[model samples]
Target: MHFDGSTWWMFYDGTSRGRRHVGLATSADGRSFTRHPRNPLVLDAGAVDVQRVGGVWVMLRESGTGTLWSTSPDGLCWVDRGRLFGLSGASTDRFGQVTPHLQVVDGVPSAIWFGGASVVSWNRNRIAVAYPDGAPAPAGSGCTACVSAGLSCAAACQSALGATGGACGMPGSTDGSRCCACAPEGCERCIGASADCHAACVSAGAAGGWCATPGSTDGSRCCACW
Candidate 1:
């Protein structure tokens, strides 16, 4: 029901064709759709468009398997960027689709998604949302810590288990100047500081102060964030 970059168009997918694909129809007006010569522009094939990058155009499809993206110049042919993100490496859930709801936030393309836990999101060329194993904390402000922990996080502050000095603030914020980690006093929270927070830690793989696990923190500790 959304318009193509120019003309009006309708998009549908993943049910009738026995494959995941995008069906397109043109309209002289915003209503009254007419199937275009190039109907079903995209098909189910394991590419970003087929089941990644969200509802064929929105930018937030979460298959629970992982987040993937497909790049295209004309919404015609697409290439797989491959697992743009996931909840946890140990995850096995598959909501069966990645709906990338891309939007410009402060003049930048940011993808919006809805699915399982550990689904983190960041903005740049486009907002990248994902988790590791399709576990908890997939979306929401906590994503920063969840993704930093490679999606194994159950809310850093909450995980502190109420220890006097263990728990911290919530996730989200702090990137490209965006805020991330919630202040220790439970005051302010970061909006896009997923990476910097990890980078500021003593080391990426350490068990103290913001570090999550190996391969998730620094290249020396965690996998070093893809």
Candidate 2:
């Protein structure tokens, strides 16, 4: 939810027949919100985080397949930009990356989310953070890693994969691990460790095959198979 001077905007998700849909509502007093005429902005998407970036409205949503991003000129009409990041292979986020929230501080942007081994189990979940660009925070500043060699999850990611950010540890136990995003050259997006890239491409029967990118077009840590 965001407040733009006179109005408060809320983005929420609802389920119909087990499918998720993203919707928008607005209110002047931040209490009684009315759904927008164009409700359900996107299908099979939820956990939306909306913000204004460079005078344009940017929305990030968690699609079942992956996290997707879109851009809107008037905040009503949007154009899909495809997957942002998906399941990292780490124990903390192996099964899911849920409830993504974006925070911008002093012109720097970071994304935080819950990582869990089971999509339905919240008690064993852990909080994860990512910088995407690998800037500002020195490696291994926050969370701990499950890896060996005394390397924090973030540090290990940076050292081994040149990852921008990573986090580790869980709320109740020390079993949780961290996931990192590494944007490789030429790739437009990054595939999470758990994503079945080969199977997805094969199922889609893409004729152009796929390629990997070193960095994300939007400055996020990403690798793409296009």
Candidate 3:
């Protein structure tokens, strides 16, 4: 809820006909809100969060598929702005992404979202933050190995892994700035700096393995053959 002098604006998730959408309401006393003539301003999206930036009102909503945003001049009208990159492309747990919120850290706008693993949090409920200004923002903070790396997740993974004498037999998944190599069913999946999928396989005793599918959420289920 935010106040614009005379009217108080409230943005919330409103349901109608078994669908969740973003809605806006106005109140003069911060209570007793009157829904806008056009309720359910947003359709087919969840995890809606609203904020005003540079005199423009922006709304963010994310799900397993991806994260997206919209802009509004008033609080009621909106213009959808495609998917939210960066964190949106990151790994998603079984339930997609959840609890998306916004915060300003060190004067930078960031989005926070959560996702769970193993049907439950399983200590893997992802509570990660994404910065619109690229990750590791403010730059030049120790990790310069990727200063001029390629933009694709696979390229980044290959460059970093190759530099460490590691080779990936296939593509990898991206999480923020780091790339993780997910090998086939009989290989070890590793997510860390300069770790290649093939290297991880050999390290885990599964030699000459194939890379797993991109954005694969399958855990380390190695095959029974040494």
How many clashes in each candidate?
64, 12, 2
Question: Top TM-score: which candidate number?
Answer: 2
lDDT of each residue in 1-226, candidate 2, tens digit only: 8788999988888999999888899999999999999888877777788877767787876534445688898788889998777765554455566667667656445554434332333333456655565554433423333444334565455456654335553422344333333333344244444222332233444322233334444323232323
For model 2, give the 10-residue run with minimal summed lDDT. 193-202
lDDT of candidates 1 onward, in order? 0.40, 0.58, 0.54
Higher-TM-score candidate of 2 and 3? 2
Candidate 3, which ten residues in sequence have the lowest lDDT sum? Answer: 115-124
Each candidate structure's TM-score, on Cα atoms with residue i matched to residue i, is 0.42, 0.57, 0.52
Q: What local lDDT does model 2 show for residue 70?
A: 85
* Candidate 3, residue 79: lDDT: 92
Give the per-residue lDDT of model 3 (tens digit) for 1-226: 8898999999888667888887778999997999988877888776688877766787877665445678889767789988665243323244455556666555456544444221222233444445555655343322223333323333334344433222222333223344344222223334333133543444666533344553443535332212
For model 1, the local distance difference test gives 0.40
Q: How far does residue 54 in candidate 3 sit from its true spot (Å)?
A: 0.9
Q: Show model 3 residue runs off by greater than 4 Å.
A: 86-95, 105-108, 111-124, 134-226
